[model samples]
Target: MRRVLLIQKAADKKDAKPEEIKKSFRTMGVTACQQMQGKKASDVEFLVSSKVGSSELLGIFENSFHLTNYENSHKKQPSEEEQEKDKEEEALDKDDRTKRINKKVDNFVVSTENTSVVEDQDYKFQQASARATEFARNLANARGSVATPEWMEHQIMDLLKKHEGKVGEVRVLQADELQKLGMNLFYNVGKGAISQPRCVIVHYEGNPEKKGEVEIALVGKGVTFDTGGLNLKPSGYMEDMYGDKGGSCAVLGALQ
Candidate 1:
């Protein structure tokens, strides 16, 4: 026997037409002859076991109800003249900014020979530290996690490898393990969503040979998505929650 499940949100219940629902189910290759209603926001899972593979069923669900004509209907084609004008304006703006920056640089003066060796060394150290901090911040705020998806992990690892000397080694901890390790404070704030919270520990041992040297440990809070959890937040308050992982991004930027 084939089964079909229709899970609709309370907000969508009134607006969802029967034909649309049926069409969505049918598109998933499931015969929507019956449906069992459930509480709001929960997935309406269907136990479909047939000759059709689960992958196919999943594909149907994924593609079903996608706005087919909306993009085409809403798309506005720019005229050739409009496109040319935009390009010209962008080029002029870029030229103006470059000229302004060059003029500023020309006014800037540096007295390298007059400065003491200690001052020069301290300046270099400060610059290196700032670079590390920026790299760390950028990684923390970077979109997505290297834990859930292998492909993404590979990509991130490759990126880290590119900055091998600066980053050293990148370690991605499992969500459950990270929680057990008492890093839940950062992870728990953005739980209960499709995107899994991850704790990425980026190691940067710039000078490892010296014994008893204090290595700088820069940590950043990475929240993939902040829904304000059980506390609940006003719509406006939650608008900028996407940037909650900015601390981590800052760490990434510093490291870079």
Candidate 2:
């Protein structure tokens, strides 16, 4: 299920009065606006037609409200120092929440339509293990500077060793080795300023009957953080740079 914003546009092209906005929404077939009227909160959630895209809805709100008063009514602005502290605290809180969720184990089946993998194969255990492992990695990755390229390599290699009996063979290529072999895929940005990128491959043969047959190969991008590379990201955009390694962690989870 998806949540969306419902916006009401006033007919008069002037400062919005409460009654005018209600009438406009009622005309537009959004009855909830009248019911939710005069509610005040830092965050607001309301139902809207799936057809109404966020851009259009936000545009309507932008046009109807008195900009300064509307923004100030909800909350006051936080100082830069407060904002940074809040961001760090939020990341730590998320880490704790994920850890708690990972401890709970339950069996569930995923139903898919028109998928390449057979629907009846029933890899539920594998999927559960993968998801838990992924959450752990994601939490670790959320910590700033802890999910570097070298750190990612160590994590992946550790997972390979932890599941040694289940996995067939694991191979790792160090940064210098990768560079010498002309595989400079991840170092285009930050070049020698940061840790050299590394790659790890895990070959798992859960079934000995099909030893020589290969069904699928999955490649995961392991750029631990994207500082927009050499270009660099402006203020607001750089906060979530650590999420760039998501694909690699996902691959690591599946392999584990």
Candidate 3:
């Protein structure tokens, strides 16, 4: 099956109807617009699996898009109370949307009628990959203050353990362990500045028969939370700091 990832702006109004919101997506005339604001990546999988339906379209609206490589638009900073309230409201909206998205993904995964004989062999890999993406998102979406490096390490370990036999191996390099290896040299301003940094290494063979070939190596930075460290971010700019671990998220999703 083929897949596509579309990133679009979130609706202007939170209460906008799905159909109206769908129309606002900048598809550039690709013709796949079914109107879904599901934030999780799995939603894309579902859309592609269904052949984009008879209408040949799907729409995904995203509200939070942060750009580190380019100039970002400036906005007036809201008060602390307003920031907290917005965060809470966003969380609630996310929870509701996730529940609906998962229902669709679960239904798609469990349905066996569409599977072909050849697809059976790849079932485990598919499931593991999807689970990895889900777990990574969980970590990324975790409450800001709670998603520390140590906490994220524990979560990754737990997720890997759940996929035991299917994956070749999983290992974690603890903060002290990394320091001993002089990995601190690679970190900014030395590792002493950041406390308890950890790394998770997942080994899952893409082709079992070619084991030990070691054809590719992937690296991802798992910064559980970025509080701007020494140079803190100004008021409103710091709200979405939890997404600093986005690189690791992509790695986790690609591993399976």
Candidate 4:
């Protein structure tokens, strides 16, 4: 059997010593771990065995998922200080009860073998959720002209129509149509491009009682990949330009 040992990055364990890590390998049942004499702790790589909690492991999975590269990422990895700052983000997200519930759900979904929960709808909806995430990920990661305003329009319409009963009033407006209504800024942005510009509108009648009244309007920008309009970016700086569509892609996924 092949064994895979996960070594925490040197940035995460800044205080670990090289010799100490090598010695700890013996207790971790990784006796074959090799160490070079001149290597620093940061350069040394070895698994530091620990019993990771469910929530902690889930956090690691989320971090890995978000860091996945679509175009063999040209950007440098986050620095130690940057990682710490991410950890320090505002905590007004939820209360303790919600966290406890999340931990329990995460643990159950990952490790439980309870067959009763394996119903048909569970499999179906889980697959749908997976597809939504994948769609959003791909759309946000698409580079170059692979995804454009008109292309995004088609995609949105296809998705909305796929679930026809749920979402209604789907339409695509051309550049001239948008300009007629005084959306010159949006119209001008895509008029020069060969693929042209399009505005996609989707409606969901969640509340039938208030049919005509609007409650929430979600906006997403499908920026032309890397071709910054008037102010162009350097070639190197334009990497992952498709990531600018993240906001809209997220809205699409949530709708899905």
- Pick by TM-score: 1 or 4, better one: 4
How do the residues 1-256 of candidate 4 rate in per-residue lDDT, one tens digit apiece?
3334344423325687755543343223221121111111112222222343223332332222222212233346767886565455425433332221111111112222333332435334544555577678777877656787767777787777667666768777886689888988877866777777777788887667778798588888777673435445677756656687788887888677
Residue-pair clashes per prediction, in order, are 28, 0, 5, 0
Estimate the lDDT of model 4.
0.53
Report how far residue 151 has shifted in candidate 4, in Å. 1.6
Q: Against the true structure, whose TM-score is highest?
A: 4
Give lDDT tens digits, candidate 2, residues 171-217: 78775777787787654563544676567777887677878787677
Q: How high is each candidate's TM-score? A: 0.40, 0.46, 0.48, 0.51
Q: Please, what are the lDDT tens digits per residue for candidate 3 over residues 1-256?
A: 4455553444358788656644553242222222222333233332223422212112121111101001112234667887677578668776543432122222222222344521443444434444556555656666657877767666666656756665776777765777778787444422443455567777877577888877577887666554336445678756776677777766766753
Model 3: clashing residue pairs? 32-57, 32-58, 33-57, 33-58, 34-58
lDDT, model 2:
0.50
Q: Model 4: C-alpha RMSD to truth?
A: 15.7
Model 4 quality (TM-score) = 0.51
What are the RMSD figures for all models against the true structure? 28.0, 14.9, 11.8, 15.7
* Cα lDDT, model 1, residue 54: 29
lDDT of 4 at 179: 83
lDDT, candidates in the order shown: 0.44, 0.50, 0.49, 0.53
lDDT of 1 by residue, 13-103 (tens): 6688756654554444322211211111112333333332223223333223121101122235667886777578658665432221111
